[model samples]
Target: MKAITIKQPWATLIALGEKQFETRSWQTKHRGPIAIHAGKSTDKDACNDSWIKSTLAEHGIKSYKELPTGVVLATAELVDCYKVETTVGHVSVLSNVKVVEGLEVAFGDYTEGRYAWELTNVQVLAKPLEAKGQLSLWEWNGDSK
Candidate 1:
């Protein structure tokens, strides 16, 4: 299976199905189910943000304490990847999707050059599988159960 290493809260948010898109600097042609790996490093600054805290709380995530790291926490379908020319256009992409305003900000960088990796059918694992992650999308042999 293909997998991508994402930083803390973002990975957690993706696993919880709260984040519909994973923003990236590059684009990918691959599509289908991919493992959502929480890299070992946490975005400490994002964790300290009040909006992040509140959004996590809304999802029953009280603190970053329980967030998994260096593991594949879930699998989501990589349906599409695109880049919008304007910030307004970027934000509008989620208008049809139900996403909290704060979460949209937390999960993506709506800059002109960034690519949004659209995901669907997110399935959080019953138990996180430990693995070392690589940059960009890499292959994972572990079962996504």
Candidate 2:
């Protein structure tokens, strides 16, 4: 399986299905089931953001300690990747289609030139597998069965 390492609260958000898009500076052609890994490093500032905290609270995540790190937390299909385009007044949309404002706010930068990697069918791992993280999409040779 292919895996992508994501920083803290964002990784938890993805695993919990609250975040549907993973923003990246680059786009990928690989589209299939991929493991979502929470890197050892956390985005401490994001964890303290009002929007992030409120969003996590809405998902029943009260503390950053509840989020797993340095492990493969879940799996989801990378269905699409599109550039985010934003206009005046915080209106943002993908280059190919319209995206919900909440999703854009929760999962993306909502700025031009960034790619939105759409994820679906998220399945959290019952037992998170410990693994070292890599920068981009990487192959995970471990048994997923």
- lDDT of all predictions, in order shown? 0.81, 0.83
How many clashing residue pairs appear in each of the predictions shown? 0, 0
* 54-99 per-residue lDDT for model 1 (tens digits): 7789888787886789899999999988764455532434323433
What value of lDDT does candidate 1 attain over all alpha carbons? 0.81
lDDT of 2 at 2: 94
Best candidate (score: TM-score)? 2
How many pairs in model 1 have backbone atoms within 3 A of each other, for residues 3 or more apart or on separate chains, i.e. clashes? 0
**For model 2, what is the alpha-carbon lDDT of residue 85?**
76
